[model samples]
Target: MDSVQFPLSTGTYSINGRKYRRTAYQMKVATDDVAQKFEQFEDTPDVYDDEPSAGCLAPPGLPALKKKIAKAKEVKEAKPESNSTEPTEDERISVIGGKKWIASISVPACFIGKLHGMNRRALNALENDTQCRVKTPRRDENKPCEISSIVSLECVQRCLDRIEIFVDDAKKTARVTHFVALPCDQHEVQENFEVFKQLVLDSEHFDASCKNPQLFTKSARLHLTLSVVCLFDDVDLQRITEAFKVIEGEIKEILNNKPMIADIQGIDMMNDDPSQVSVIYAKVSGEKIQEVANHLNRRLIELGFAKNEGGDEVKLHMTLMNARYVAQAEKLKKFTFDAKKILEDLKESYFGTFQLTEICLCPLNSNSSSEKFYDKLAIMRLA
Candidate 1:
């Protein structure tokens, strides 16, 4: 009991990382003591924070500095950024006042991942400072190494395994009509979504501004958004539907052996900061998941209804929350959530696996209004 010892006096200091990540919302602050003590459990014996010594997380020479600043609200004590999770005040959808048909695949709701070992004090500091964010690992650390060497031939063999996820920014693109997708049921994944939602809402690490619990996502609305399609004409819908029919048997054939299974893991932000998050999604992974996505995207692109955004490369993610509105981009930017901290805390979380059985064609009403984001237009199942 109480085996550790603290020789230095109780005071405050600050910690800063290398640079600000553009994809995440973060609040920066100083000090590894008081608040940081909780985030960084192990501390060096150095009396001052001005110079980095051994066993520190930051690089050397970048000393922890003494700085006095007003204590912002603690995560637990701070009120939620949004009174309700269902954000109704700001509607940030790109296409509004109408619905479009698209193809998409649905993954099970419980497929979210899980993580552990986060510093609470770090979360508190981030919550207080509002300008800093957690830095993700470099390319290889996040994904399997793309390049491999053939030792026998003494030659390097590979292209970097990367998913080129653009913002669907294809100019001169026709109307976004139908998308291919795999759908999930609320009964299968709602309970976990609710739990994760509540955890984010109650955690002190989160900034609750403008967040609505209702906006998290309805169980009925859970599904993976595959690709954005462009319709361009009244006859396009028929063509798109027929194109799907053309390859429906093949897709089912791929999934026919058994229900496709995958895990729904932890959460991540679409951008660097959580505060300006347009979408929050759970990481998903499984065997041959890439093959399924590739097949679907190939067929859709072949018919000229969808763009080959990633080309046999699929980003397997399930969108959990959104702050988008048809008419409110600037307003939404001002309202940031603590998705970063929440993601860190649950980095090792695993919601469970999804036995994906079928794919569907659904209609998108408005990206802003997600209560019933899509209506089931058609369904095709594996034999």
Candidate 2:
């Protein structure tokens, strides 16, 4: 009988003058045995026997095999060490100082006025449980709440989580709460509007029954509304501002870097009957002005901040008078003014043309500034 011989290069064995190929099972068993030997060697000292067993003989590809095994062992050893020391997602903390943690959350501006029992209950519970310092913005303030320092970092995180849930719920049912407009703030334009306003107040054709001084728009607050939008909070305001900033270049391009001239001529009522009008406005017209207004309306609608009431064309007009400004008690009866006579008298009234300098995103029903301009959330300069 011939001695069995294994050929390292061919991966075959010769026995009793016969040759046989190594099966997958045999290769797997050999690999397992080698791995077990390597593990046992790692645990023991570096001492080696002068003479090795026949089964422990190195294979033809031992150098490459040793390198691969060493790399795999290193990776296996490092994995547990890394996992044991690093924190999990839930365990992570945003430390501000020694054992102090801080967390913040955004609350929509509309949430202040719309707060219900559920919101109050949640907020009260958070305050009582965490004893955390909760700083929320006022109704008029566009800012996020700053929550900091509780028994532990987890408490602050919990406070933020609850607030976020409340804010998310409020956002789902939010309405259009703002508008975008091109402010007619030129000194010349304001003086012209003041003249027009005085004319309406003193004209014999103006109806005495509807001539409440409060019905007139402030000269400083005069503007041609582009579109109305729903801005729930500072985050929404920031997003819309960024969106406008991106398209501002397009608006500037349309104007060709020249100051856009808006022609304010003629007087009109929003309703056809002029006899029972709730809104009186000055007609705004100019090729470039209309283009910019239409572009803004379209972009705002596409961004989901505004709705498309009808066509893409934005009707440009600066509101001169509104009956909604009437006293709260009389407003319930739906007070309106007779604008028919005033319309006939000022039909072709030119309130003068002025350069369009800036467009503003302003909050509705906000208190006017000292200069009598509506508080602007954002302003885009055209010239």
Candidate 3:
């Protein structure tokens, strides 16, 4: 009922336009006699791995050897040795960050293109200023700053396409995207991606260290950094002070409430320290205090600087330090509660009001070497 025939196998497969050897072995062993033959064949095959014959992709002749030599040459030519020196971290920033970042207040669509143009200008400047061998494409890819773009009709359409919802002043909504994929433009994603790339690069101070040398490092722990900033409008100092009263009321009420739990951190609400709260409450002044605060808070949210408890609008304040530096950096982490709950508790337990009008750019020096000094760049008053 069973009959079978085995044939000698020889074939070749092509991969990446090159041929590879293919050999097949087939036999049927039904009894002890055939089993012994199979065992003998295993011990000594008709074709050994070292043996070369016709149709084999690789052979022991000058032709095969020439092919191997050609391949070696190709690889050698493909990647030329570096005649140019690689730039240090600081140089990379200088090469990229030389352009000024212009942020638009009322116009949102002019954001990306303006950044791109500035980046191009920065690269051109770098090329003119340095002897470093810079490639045009590499320069094109450099995006040193984040700022408003010179808007075109097409850019406006794109911005409108990406907008999920609209918010009027004094309104809260939950449609915010948890995360946005950066450089959504596919045509120049890599080039435009650098708009945010340098901000996260390893600090220049510790790049020289062979081990544990970074002046700043990422941590798994999370904490809240808030900024209290004030911006004066079309008014004098008296009006600014009056505006501060409104902001002050909001701050005091939120602090007095002191929620039982921070919905975001899922931690004790009131047990956090007072100094941290103090840092968040410090007053700073500038014409654009509100604008700066809004920008900072928006950036923190965009970059996930802190887990939001999903309560109210994030208060405008400089995030002085993270939880990792809480032990040494002014010991401020103890003061920030579930600001949402804290404010709610304060509103219910005590009546506190705020009239905020100025923005302060303060230095947060965490004693840890792994954390670097950051500038609180701007401050604006909220209308």
Candidate 4:
């Protein structure tokens, strides 16, 4: 027997070594019959339902296909319900003062400084950018800032959002309570600092001009402040300590297991005027010292313990004299010293060099011991 051929493009099929083609009318009739049979099957809910028959086998994708169809039907049924209930953006906005909208946000008194810079310039900028009216609180007022707009609540919300970001940044950069420092109490540094203190105290010009001699910094309390932070309580202290502990290893690695040799020399007043000075400090300088100080300060900010304060470079100075020190001397009124003679005399004086063995976390309000250094709450060794 000859091999049978399959259906051809000409619409003819071969079977049992014979070929036959149906007319167009016959083809149409056959198609109609097949479609009608499928319609009947669909109408019989039991046979053509989403679930497969218990005795029939199911394909691997049959369950997934059924779930998809069920989900699509649910979505179609829910569309009208959602359309009927949901409000448009404009309707969702709460109306206040008829056409105008308003929002009040409470702010802390400490953050009032942050709002001060929102002056006429900043207000104009905000109005132009948001096309809204923002009434900033007064410097002394602890009240909330008011925002309003005739356009939309979203515009007022935008102004509020900008103010919040500005205040948040101010908080991060302004608050501080404790400080990190390297004590300047090594034997050689202390000896030199004492000599400089004595020179200022002994000068008749300095002595007569400054009646209060107790304004000098105690030798034991000499230190180079590295960074400052605002810690609220013991819990905050513990949190900061843990943060410090983690960064301690990085600081040590930065030092490369070597003690920092700090060069303390020369005398300079904190204020620009040399004649009327409230603070006198010995200049501290060195490459490694600055590198370590900057790294520690940057890490403190990254860890959120300290403020950024505009820069990472630590102003390394060992304060030798401050007028505030006179507060301990018999409830005296705060005084400034005439450092004109002192400046002329010791302008080129060298304090001395010493090895910084450790970095310490110290309280700002605590009294210094006989050793002259503030109480160290925590210490990280450099060598």
Candidate 5:
């Protein structure tokens, strides 16, 4: 069967007299090899009543197809260089063990610098152990969720298992490892976040009377987590990188030479259910964002390099805070914070647009205090 893939732009698109909405740029893959193989059947639309779930393994011949494409690409590269000035902009995708590696991109520099500055402020705030909690917004006041969670046993187990690993080390610096994400700079919208944080430090927490709050998220460490691999090591990175190289063409195709100018505005709350610490994050929108996340995550799972984080789609957001440190603190391991109250005030407020440059394969929370949050193992840029 033949499959066609393409980028779905953000907008309301009409088909079969029906209108559908999509937010970010997303990858769409459909297979009708029987029809695509024959020119006479090309015009016919092949509808899938139930498409294969994201967790399913790739159909046979995928590896051979990858090798064929790589061979063809190699032949094309053999023709070699037009060293013209414009040609310099094209940097070949990095290869490891003779394979392309999976990588992530970066946000604009000015935005990242602002995030670092905010991180410094966040770090300074740590000096004062202020306790807080989330006040639930009246159900009517909040908007619908931008990102959805898949409630599969696999997902639940994966997240909980990872949490368990870190739960033991809450006192020391956490190396809560292995997650896929997109970087974004939100300082422009969060200019007064430091003050807002102060309010959180002094505010009353819902459901808890404790004066101590959970540890705050470092602004510099902000990212829209795509998938959590749960447990990963150097060997895992090696396996993941080669697996990514095999599908490099498809990844590029999904990107469709599109530049990453994303609208990462708004604040929102994400949580599993009614609990104490609601995850507060700046909202991210678009199909490209979701598709890229699904593509990378699904591919890795298929290769046995990683596992699914419940569902395929990623709800994009740069997480601002959670009580991650609460249970791990040596002295204040369990401080409560009213993340819901803070989110209620900023939830609909616009942040701004961000221009994404490259994608780097970052080791999750593996950086030292002196290092940048992204310890890139491999890097790639869009044309």
Candidate 6:
């Protein structure tokens, strides 16, 4: 027997519809290796039974061959199973710090002046007491106190933390401090807060110039000055007077209800006890007089500021009030002129006659040197 025909190639095979002559190399590993290896070679006689049956089998090394076939089937199934596995490492968690605190900065000029002008020791005591609530706290707490004190303490703490307490001998300024926080690679936390602090330090705030003499007394003049008065010719003045009379009639009717009167600053006046007050000023061009009348008519319906019963229009007044006091003065006697009297006279003389040319929005800074009035920041002309 040939060596190739030995048990080395002794495997069962099955035949299909046809057979082909094959070369010696092809016989070793043929294209239809499974069918050739599992071909059955047993003989059997036909029976008359009409029942269907499974295919016949060969007994030549069939047990060992079935084991090899089953092993190959398992390997084929495992290729995709191994490829479908996922990674098995643990994920991580990260932490983010909190937001930085911010506060605006302004000098205690107004509040401090109010305390000093009235000689109110209690006010000072109150102010100091309020400040002390946050200051001079129990040292045992070992914590910073007061807003300002905390800011100052933070500066000192920074220096101490870095162990840089050397003060400059010539300049008399505190030494610079540096700290290397181990967890924070880049000082991003402190840098963010520093940016916020700088913004507050650079913001625009009310300031007082000590060189100005009129800032605190009754004569205390502000930098910005506002003047409002009724302007009209003798003819237009008649129209205003007539309109005033018309509104006065309605006011008299409203007064019939007998509203409560109060001594407001020694001046008797009707009080509505309004919860909130809003100042409204409507400016119209001369060409828009009809439109202005229509607008006022709607306003009168809402507030009933008109007479003639069903008419919706209200009286048009140029001046809202004669004189207005924007700032409170503790020492009125110190002013050169009587501000109260000036305001009263200005109010009494006010008659709605001024032509609406432009509306100005101004900012009051402080008392100006030339006019002793509040200065304007920038005038915006109404479009």
TM-scores of the candidates in the order shown = 0.49, 0.58, 0.18, 0.54, 0.46, 0.18
Model 3, position 259: C-alpha lDDT score:
23
Model 2 scores worst on lDDT over the 10 consecutive residues at: 37-46
CA lDDT of 26 in candidate 1?
Answer: 32
Model 4: how far residue 91 lies from native, Å? 31
lDDT scores of the candidates, listed in order: 0.53, 0.75, 0.31, 0.73, 0.51, 0.28
Q: Per-residue CA lDDT of candidate 3, range 125-154, in tens?
A: 433333222222122343222222232223
Q: Whole-model lDDT for model 6 versus the true structure?
A: 0.28
lDDT of 5 at 102: 18
Those runs of model 3 whose alpha carbons end farther than 4 Å from true positions after fitting are 1-296, 299-326, 329-351, 366-377, 381-383
Evaluated with TM-score, which candidate comes out highest? 2
Order the candidate numbers by lDDT, best to worst.
Answer: 2, 4, 1, 5, 3, 6
Better of 1 and 5 by TM-score: 1
Candidate 5 TM-score versus the reference: 0.46
Q: What is the lDDT of residue 263 in candidate 3?
A: 18
Candidate 5, position 74, lDDT? 100
Worst 10 residues of 3 by lDDT: 177-186
**Per-residue lDDT of candidate 5, residues 1-383 (tens digit):** 79898644445668899995433322335448564332231222324324653445575577998999999999989976443222111131122232212112222222222322465453223222222111212234332111111222233233333333433343123333566666653575345444545565776643342134445565556566766653333445666666556655676788787766667666666664434554666777765867877787787667654555467765677766665555566555554455555556556655567666555566655655622456666555544
With a 3 Å backbone cut-off (N, CA, C), the pairs that clash in candidate 2 are: none
lDDT digits (tens) for residues 26-141 of candidate 1: 34445555563223333433355455544646544444331212233455357545432221122311111122111111111111111001544533343233322222223233
For model 2, what is the error of residue 263's alpha carbon versus the real structure, in angstroms, after optimal superposition? 0.8
Ten-residue stretch with the least lDDT total in model 1 = 157-166
After superposition on all C-alphas, the RMSD of every candidate to the true structure, in Å, is 36.4, 18.3, 29.1, 19.5, 36.0, 28.4
- Which consecutive 10 residues in model 4 have the weakest lDDT in total? 38-47
Better of 2 and 6 by lDDT: 2
